[model samples]
Every structure is written in C-alpha cells, then in structure tokens.
Target: MTQPTIVFSPLQAGVPAAGGALEVLVRVQAPDRPTDLATAHLPKRLALVVDRSGSMNGQPLQEALRCVTHIASHLTSQDALALVVYDDKVDTLLPLQPMRSTDAVAKAVAGVEAGGMTNLHGGWLAGAQQLEGGTEQTVSRVILLSDGQANHGETDLSAIEAQCREWLGRGVSTTTVGLGRGFNEDLMIGMARAGGGQNYYGETAADLYDSFDEELALLQAMYLRQVGLKLLPAAGVIVEMISPAQQLADGSWRMTDLAWGAEAWVAVRLHLSPGMAGQTRDLLAASVSGTALDGTQLQAHAPVLQLPVLDAAAMQALPRNETAYTRLEELAFAKASEHLRQLAKEGDRQATQQALDVLEKRFGHHPWLSAKIKQLRQLADEDSEMMAKEVRYSMMRMSRRLVSKEEMAYEGDETHVSESVMPSFMRKKVSEGKGKKREV
Candidate 1:
C-alpha cells in the first residue's frame, strides 16, 4: 500500500489554449486510521480548563464537571491529564499527572463548585502552565469550557489571541468551548484559530456532551494536526488562496489539519499564461510539511499538476469539476455568513437583506445552499446574532476539518472516528455516537 501523502487536484480538466487563469483545489489525504500499530500516535496531554464564574452556577457548572469527567475517563495510561477552574481567582482541581487512574481525579472533580467572576485568561494560562513540561513527543491541548465573557482580567481579544499563538509555538494548543449565549463567540473562535485548535460551542449545558465527544473523536482520528504547504507556481502565475491560512516565516501557508480517512482542502485561483494546445505542462509544484500520526516529522512533495492547453472556446466548454465547485461554494457560504453577521451587527437590515439576495443569486443552483440562504434570511429577520454565532461556529469547523455533507447537515457526527488508539475506558464515548464494539 502507498503511504498516505499530499495530492493536488485541479478543477479544470486542462488549461485553455489561450489560458489566462484557472482554479484548483489542493487535497491532503490520510490513507487509514491508525490501526494495530502501537506507536502510531503521540502521547496526548490534555488540560481541562473550566470557567466557574457566576454564570455557570447551576446546570452549566454541573455539566461542565461532567464534560471534564467524560474527557478524563478515556485517556490511555501513556497520556496525561490536568484540571483547572477559575472565576476571579484560579484553582487547580487536579495537578498534571499521567493517566494511571481516574480515582484521584474523580475525587478532585466531586467537590468543585461555581465561584465569582470570569477570569477567562487566568484559567487558560493556568491550564497551559500545567502542561508546561510538554515536549515534541506529546500532543498537549487545553480544552477550556467557559460560559461568560472575560470580565475579570486581560479582556483584550487581540492580546489573548496573541498569547494563544505564542503557546502554540511552545507545543501547547487551546481548544475552547463556549456554553450558552453569554460567552463571547468572537473571543472563543478567535482564540482557537490562533492557538491552532478547533473551536466548538453549544447553546445549552447539555450540548457540552456532544462537543466533548466530537472533540475526543477527532483527537483519536487526528493524523496531522498542523500542515503547511509551499506552492511553487509556474513562472508568472499569480495565485490567490481562498482558505483562511496563516503564512509562516518560511513562506509556506499553514492549512487545516488532516484527519484519518478524510481529506483536507484549500481552493485557489491561479492566473496563467497561454500555452500550446498539443503539449501538457506542469503548472504547479507543491511540497508539504507536518508531523505524522506517530509524531515523526514529515516532508514530501505532491505530484505536479500537468495541464493540457486548449483554445478559449474549448476551455470554456469544459465541464466544471463537481468536487471543486462544491468546495468553492462551501467557502463562499462561510464567507457570506460572516458578512451577513457583520452587517446585522451594524444594524443595517437592508444591507443584510441585500447580502442574502446576492448570496441566493450566486448559489441558487445548489438546493442545500438555497436552504442555508433561507435559514440565514430567517435568522437575519429574527435573531441575527444567534444565526451569526451558529454559522460562525460551523465556519470554524469547516476551516479546521474536512466536513462532509452528512456532517454538515447533522452538525456533530463522529461515526467515522476511530477508537483504535484510545484506551479501554475512554473508548466508550467513541461508541456512544455510533455504537460499535471495539477491541478494548
């Protein structure tokens, strides 16, 4: 079997005879989930950071404790766990330790209760501190559960996001969960983006379970958490990437993570020059860099895209790549949702309607997207803010993972997530989503 590697697929069948521009969608695929290989995955180190502020006094706090417990119950002996909760002051419910047993951790979680105000920053910082000894061998993540905005200390979104990015460089990534409508969606979403982790949210306390389960499933299926691509375009070709990517100091663009048995993609528009119709030429060369499933460094080159030149009319007559079309549309939908939310925030109802109308006209061909159009319109007419949060969360997920149409419709489906790497105790949640007997 071939080792899973990065691959590039273009939307166009071939370059036009008078080629001026074209589009391509790059995909990175992992062949299979880590199976019987014992060393297939890195040791996971997770910190459960919960906000025990006044807002989480009742069900939120209770469910949050349950969420922490849900995450803790599944770790393998090689993995590690820590617990931190904060309001005006921070508290470490459980010090960082290897997952030898959940007994002591259970006792620590039992006496926890809600406290005062939201010192969101302090809690997250404490969580990172707990994982301070993390090295390249361990995948350290701080899963924060919060129910309110940062009102106590260091409330600036920019500064918080910068700190999260700094921690990412130190082998610590932050995954934030927002419970209820009270927490700042912008901050939660932004922090996750900078910290190199996926952002998740729920409308009620009960929804926290799904968030925790889905996150754990993804972690279990995680192949490459951080991937960067350097595009070596043909001379004179100008490229514009549609995906939200962070440019590295080395000039490569950081892209979304690739999960086991799934594909991660980025859409790009390229400006090309005319070529002869009889000959095919390599238009783009790409090299990928990231950590593999076993924590081994990965560096490889994808096959070059060779396109056949064609005449203007012939090229225009070619059929669109259905896959690329759907991906481009998905990217457009996410962007429209963002724009609609911003307009709604400005109190410009007319502009919001105009945006929706334009979106409908643009994506009116796809029935599913048409449905989204209607949903966005309804939300704009009624609760635009709610629509904004919900759609933005979906956008965050789309940007981080390769979302299938089924996952898009259902929102939190983890049936395909593998439990091959999870410990016997922790593998239970893996079956809850889609009951499957595992070899514990």
Candidate 2:
C-alpha cells in the first residue's frame, strides 16, 4: 500500500503559555506514485440518472443525450453502466452491463424523449438501486443529472439527502450535475455533500462534457473513497472543523475522497484552556480513515502534536508556519466570496464593494490571493448568479480538498484549466484550448 501522509501543523510553531484558541492546519495527502495507478484503478460501475422533463424538451435534452453517449463511448470493457431517465415517472432505460459495446445503450438513449414533471428523487433512487451490493474492488457511483426542480415525487430535500448518505454507507456514492441554472443547486449540492461525492454544474453540451471528463479523471486516479477525518483535542481543547464537512452517523467529519497523489485536508480551529507556564504539551490527535480501492479499510493516525508552552517574549520570537497561515487565508477568502455572493444577489452593490475591499486589504498582499479577490470583484459586477453558483460549489470543494491557487481560479473560470490547473494524469484527457469551447 502507498500509505498516505497526514500531518498536523499549528499556525504558530509553539503554543503560548496562556492558551485560548489555537488553529491547526491538517493535511492528508495521497501519495503520487506511477506504479500505484495500475493497482488503484480497478473496474468501475456507474449509473446515469438523467432528468428528461418537459423543461428539457429541446437543447437541454439534446445536450444530455450527447453527454450520455459521449460517456458510454469512452467506457472500457471492464466497466459497467446503467441508465435511468425520469420525468413524472421513472424508467430504467438500460440495466447494468459491461461496456464491450455501446450499441445497446445507444439504442436505449435514442428511445429517450422529454417527458412530464421532474421526479428527481425517484430517478436518483432508481439509479442507486441498480448498484446494490457493490464490492470493494469496483467503484460504484450514480451521476444524477437534472435541469429543474423536483416537484412530482419525494421532493423532501432532507429525506433525499439522507438517502444519499445511506447509499454512501452501502458502498455506492452519488455525484450530481445540475444541467442549467434552473436546477436546484442546493438539492444537488446537498446530496453530493452527504453522499460523499462531487457536485458540478454546466450550461452547455461542451461544459457538461468537461465536467464529466474531470470526474472520470478523478475516479480513474482515486486511491480511496468515503474518506473521513477526526480530531481528538487534548484536555481543555475544543476543536471545530473550519472547512466544510458532513457529520457522519459515527460523528466524524466526512470529506471528499482521495485521488492518488492528490490531497484532502481540513482546517480546524482549536480552543484551548490556559496551560501552566514553562511546560510542553500535546495539543491534539487526528486520524484519516477510508475504504481502499479493493474494499480494504485503511487509516493513518498523525503523531502526537507537541508544542512547548512559552512566555510572552519567547512566544513572540517563535517562527510561524507561513504556508499554514495561507490555508487560513484561503478559508477566509472562500467565506468572503460566499458573503459577496449573497450581497450581490440582494443588489447591494455598495456592501459588495465594501466586502471586496475588506478581502483585498487582508488577502491582497499575496499575488495569488489578490488575483482571486479581483476576479470575484469583477464577477460580482458582471454576473452575480453565475458567481453565486461558483462560490457555493467552490466552498463545497474547498472544504474537502487541498486545492492550489490554480485550481481555485479554474473553478471560477474553466478557460484556463487545460493549461493551468489539471495534473499530469488529466492533461491528455483535456487537450489544449479545449476550455475556449466551454461557455463557463
């Protein structure tokens, strides 16, 4: 096994004698090994639950079909795909079958036409049912695609999200793709968060294809799924997950899964009671747990984090982890962008600029963070709704993944992903200048 590295870094090198609140940046980075690629990527099983409602009567339906076909055409013989379409009613267009040929699925896709209302929950549930009893070696997921709200059946948002979480425990994950602006972003994103999967949105056929491509690349390079993180604070220390997290039944914070050579992290804010002067102390304990590709359970526990208790002068002389502070800034920037989105939606331009100014003042010193602030500033003025979706979706992603500045920028503007963001494994899948074709 290519053991993952989990490190706990304090914002300051050492704790002050009079401790109150301490923030720790926790990172779980998946090892990137060329040899692990062959061992990590086993066969995959996918269920595509597509919304074929009345609202999708034209271009929407066409693009969806095109995307389904595109995905089917790319699957290897070792993979399996199941198709389900829902409107007012639900139908399984195709049962789970190996991908030796796309002929059968193609015919099934051709027969699909836009129907009545959007039974979003029913469609997703049907897709999950198809992947029941998935073993450890096979990666199973449901790609729930929708263009509108669910009004016909099981429209309860909480119920739907809970089911997604339940299915995740059964070895099946869920990824939601909102076809257009009309789809319920909250519902789609909520299900993904709870189900321990990804949430994405696209406006066109090319955009959909791009989203699908990213997902496939991530899956093909995955080492573990349903990754969870837990922090054990020492006596008198209270810990909170600053990053976005879903509370599991067992109380651990569930994060996005791990891709080989990639990183999943959580920013934790620790509150500590006062410690005795001139003493060394252990701050907290942490563990990263997940299911490996072949169904084996794995975990990595971080070493006991120890810091020396120092007096005022000594604490002032301590060196800070500059890199760790940047993570806190990243978290702040994400939250600020979300605030800016809400202000923009309310048509409060003055407050929006004020918030942007605050972000610029705090994060503008760094060249990279400054760029993001300006990017959000311009986006708020030009398109608030699009900016809203980007920030919300980004917050969900950032809370789980340890992304770089380039990746963050790509979330707001995909025109640069092919050139700036993707890893080596994804370079071939997304060609140069492909982002230009995308409307995002």
Candidate 3:
C-alpha cells in the first residue's frame, strides 16, 4: 500500500532581525495511487436517520425518501444498514441488518409520513445505537437528515455535543445534513464536528440528492481514518490552529477521515519571539498518524522548517510561495465568516455590521468576497437566521469551492452524478467572477 505524504511551507523569506510574524502551511497528500472502489471493498455499517417533522409534509419528505431510495439501491450485500425516522418520537423503520435485500428497506422508507415536532437527539441516538453491533473493521456511520431545530428531548447544544462525542468515542461517525432554511445550522455543524464527521447543507428539495450522492462518493473513496496530527513547535513559539478540531489536553488536534485522491491542509499561525541576529532556529515540526485503507497503521513526519534571523534586506531577497499565501487568505476569510455568523446568531446586529466593516476594509479588493460580504450585510438586516445559515454553509464548503476544475472532476462511470453538487452561494460566486483572480 502507498503511504500519504506530508509537506510544510514556512515563510519563504527569513524573519526580520528583531523577529516578525510567522505562518506555516501544512499539506497532507493522499496515497500515490488513485482509489479503486471495486478493489478496496471496505465494508460499511450505515444508519440512515431521517427527520419527519411537520414541515417535511410535502416536497421535502418526498425528496428525502427518494434520496434514501437511491442510497439504498447502491449498497452491497456485505454492508449493514439501518433506517430510523423521527418526529417528536423515534421509529426504527428498518432494524439494523446486512443489505442482502434492499427491496424491504426501500419499502420501509416509502411508508414514512411527516408529523409533529423534531426530536433530533432521540432520533440521532437511536441511529448510533444500531451500529454498535457492527464489526470493528466496518466503516460505521450515521447519516442524519433534519429540517428543523431540536424542539423536544434534550435540545441544548452543549448536551447534544456531549452526546455526539460519546457516540464518536464508540467508533461511529455522524455526518449531518441540514435539509433546508428552517434547520439550525449551528447545531448541525457543532454536532458533526463533535462526532468527527462531515456537515452538509441542502437548500432546496432537489439539492438533497446532491448532498446524498457526494457523501456516498466520499465514503466509497475514503482511505484513512483516526487521523491525528501532533504538532511539536519549537520552544518559545506559540501555535494557533485554524481548522475545525477537538483540541486535546496535550495541545494536539483530532481530525476526521481522509479520502483517496483528496488532500487535507492545516494552517497554523506561529507567534515568535525576537532572536539574536545572524542565527538560525527551528520553527515547527509535525508528525501524522492514521489508519490506512488496508487496515494498517501509517505514520509520517513533515520536514522541520527553520527560520533565519537576518537583515531586513536579506530577508526581502527570498522568494515566497504564492500558493501558500492564497491558501492563508482563504483560511482568514473562513475564520472571519464564522465569527460574523456567530455574532449574527446572537442578534447583535451592530456587532455583526462592525465585523463586516472590518472584513471589507481587509478584503474589499476581491470581487467575490466583497460581493458575498455585501449580500450577508443585507441579509443580516433583513433576516438574521438566513444570514447565519448562509455564512456557516459558505465557510463549511469553502475548500470545495476553491478546488481546481481537475480536482472537482470524476473519472468513474457514475453517470448519475451529472448535476452540480456545489451550494447555491458557491455557484453564484463562481458565476460572478468572470474569470477573475481567486482569493483561495
């Protein structure tokens, strides 16, 4: 089996003689060989948890059931599957069992009807329980679909995060899909992060299929799990991670799964103290540990990058990595967007506007981002819920939006995935650019 590669890009030019800012871009490349889904044959234990709240009575419920049908039809006999539906009460539509016959599962999904308020916690927990009986070698996951807030049975965000963390500790990952504008984006995003899984947004009924298909593609292509990075920063240097994670007590961060032919990048800003002139010092070091696709342990260390404290002129003579700078800009925008969204969620209109003003002053030159900022400011004034949801979705999918055309393309004969799977905001942003320079 091929091993993943680790590369680090530090500040190209040396630091100022009296010490200056430092930023490092850490990129983890997937295995050298492309993933072969037919050959990999990774077994999956999947739980499909669908919300049947009153709001999903019409097209929403129909679309959800149709999507689930598509997902069921693609499963193999070796995979274990469970279906759960909830609306103020939980119902196990189909008990956990291997997919030897999908007809019964599809029939069960078709019989679900929408009613009552959402009991998100109960539904999600029931789904997680179904996977507990699966083998340790299976890739166990819960695909949670919801179109409303948690109105019954443990609605608190903290409580929900704790519960999800408990499930993740038991080796089950939960991937959350917010069905429409009515869903609470913050709650879904938080739950997914705590579960060490992926989060998605479906703006319209038609969008549900895209979210379902993309997630399936990822699962079928995933090659690594238990991904963790140990950062060994040089003494006296402070490290601040800009990625979503569960920070360990020892200062390391826990990451999610890594798929084949995909790249995971982590960005960290280093705060350094001034050193004596004409001397070199180690900036940072990192080691990656994870479980590979073939059920083998994998470990790789990134090269240590050293910084030189030199004259300002000498530092200016060095070449910089333009790609690294672009990636950093993307990370900064994502961070600011998240902060602004949180402010909007709290109904602090003034603070939200102030944050937007600051971002405009910093990134107004970029057309797409500037347009997005303006759109968000208007939404904040008119509808805070919409603004918050938009911000979270945009930031969550930023990396996918910035990927090159080749990276987004698929080589397999999966002809059903012809529709655009990107979020609506991303589509609009890409269309307005007219081939302008991308900030990410």
Question: Which model, 1 or 3, shows the larger lDDT?
Answer: 1
Off by over 4 Å in 1: 1-3, 38-42, 100-103, 135-137, 343-358, 371-382, 403-440
Off by over 4 Å in 2: 34-41, 347-354, 366-369, 402-440
- Per-residue lDDT over 1-440 for candidate 1, one digit per residue giving the tens place of the 0 to 100 score: 22446666577788876767787888766666545643455578999899999889988888778778777787878889999999999999888988888887789878888889999999999999899867766688999989799999899999999999899877788999887667898999888988888776765545555556666666766667578888888875778888887788898887766666666667788888777887887788888777765567777788778877887787788888877777777677777678777887776878989988998998878655666667667777887666667667656544445643122332222333454433221221211112222223
Write one digit per residue (lDDT tens) for candidate 3, span 1-440: 67777777765747666666777777766763453454666788899999998988988887677757767877898888899999999999988888888788878976899999999999999999998855556788998988898999999999999888888767788889887668888899888888877777665545555455556666766767767778888877888876555676666567657776556667777887888778988888888878765668888887787878877788788787765676676667877787898898899999999999999998776555676788788888988877888787667655423232124322322223332443222132321111211111
Clashing pairs in 2: none
Error of 3 at 333 (Å): 1.2
Ten-residue region with minimum lDDT total, candidate 2: 427-436
Candidate 1 versus the native: TM-score?
0.84
Per-candidate TM vs. native?
A: 0.84, 0.89, 0.82
Best-to-worst order by TM-score is 2, 1, 3
Taken over the whole model, the C-alpha lDDT of each candidate is 0.73, 0.76, 0.73
**Candidate 2 lDDT (Cα, 0 to 1):** 0.76
Error of 3 at 266 (Å): 1.6
